[model samples]
Target chain A: MKKVIVHVTLKEGVLDPQGQTIETSLHSLGFTEVEEVRTGKTIELLLDNHDNVEARVQDMCTKLLANPVIEDYRVNVEEAVQS
Target chain B: MKKVIVHVTLKEGVLDPQGQTIETSLHSLGFTEVEEVRTGKTIELLLDNHDNVEARVQDMCTKLLANPVIEDYRVNVEEAVQS
Candidate 1:
């Protein structure tokens, strides 16, 4: 099996209210050293063995997993050990 | 500076409706080889240099970034290269 990990993060310069909230909350919680925080999505998929897995996974990210206009996504494909 | 990455994922056996929906959607999009899907959060933080950075990041995860009851979190700390 193939294990694919897609990280979808907001593009730089985009406003991230959720991240701002988290940063403020962290400071209030006594983590004062925190300068910035950004939150994103991690999508993991288990797939049957197939050719062009990375390309196909990228297609999935573009088609559904990520918003290309406001987000950037990175795809990493790994071979899952047989159990 | 320090860069910390916290990956918060649902524990095994926890029902992930969102993942299921994504999997179904991928299949409908013709990526039928996808067998399973899981979703999680990727939190990236920038922090001023401090003592025991990993421990502090772990504390942040426990107190805010992750729900210890149903989620597992992993932290990776890296030294930010001076630019």
Candidate 2:
């Protein structure tokens, strides 16, 4: 089995209100060390054999996991390594 | 500045309905390669400076980002590298 990790992040220049809220809250809490914050999603999957793990996962990202108009996704595949 | 990446994932044995839905959808869509799927949150913070970056981010994770009762979090802090 293989483990598929997908990271979906906001594209540059896209507005992220949630991130802005976190920044303000952090500053209010005296954590003025922050400039900005961007929220994202991580989807992990355990899968059987696939012809091309990366490509298949990327297809998933484009088809469902991420919004291509505003988000970019990165895919990482690793052996499940069950022990 | 530093970019703080916090990954919040469900603890083992915790049920993930969203992930399960995605899996089922994927399989129904003829991509039966996946056996299981887990969904999580990724928070990216662009910060100025905090004496100890990792500790501060982890604190945020425990305090607001993740529920210790059912989720585990990992923190990764890197230089902002403004160009």
The lDDT of each candidate is 0.93, 0.85
Worst 10-residue lDDT window, candidate 2 chain B:
B74-83
Q: In candidate 2, what are the lDDT values of residues B27-76, reduced to their tens digit?
A: 88778888899999888888776688888777777767789999998888
DockQ of 1: 0.91
- Model 2 CAPRI rating: high
lDDT of 1 by residue, A8-79 (tens): 999999988999999999999999999999999999999998888999998998899999999999998876
**Candidate 1 lDDT:** 0.93
Name the runs in model 2 displaced over 4 angstroms. none
Model 1, position B38, has a per-residue lDDT of 98
CAPRI category for model 1: high
Chain A superposition TM-score per model: 0.93, 0.91
DockQ values, each candidate: 0.91, 0.80
Q: Clashing residue pairs, candidate 1?
A: none
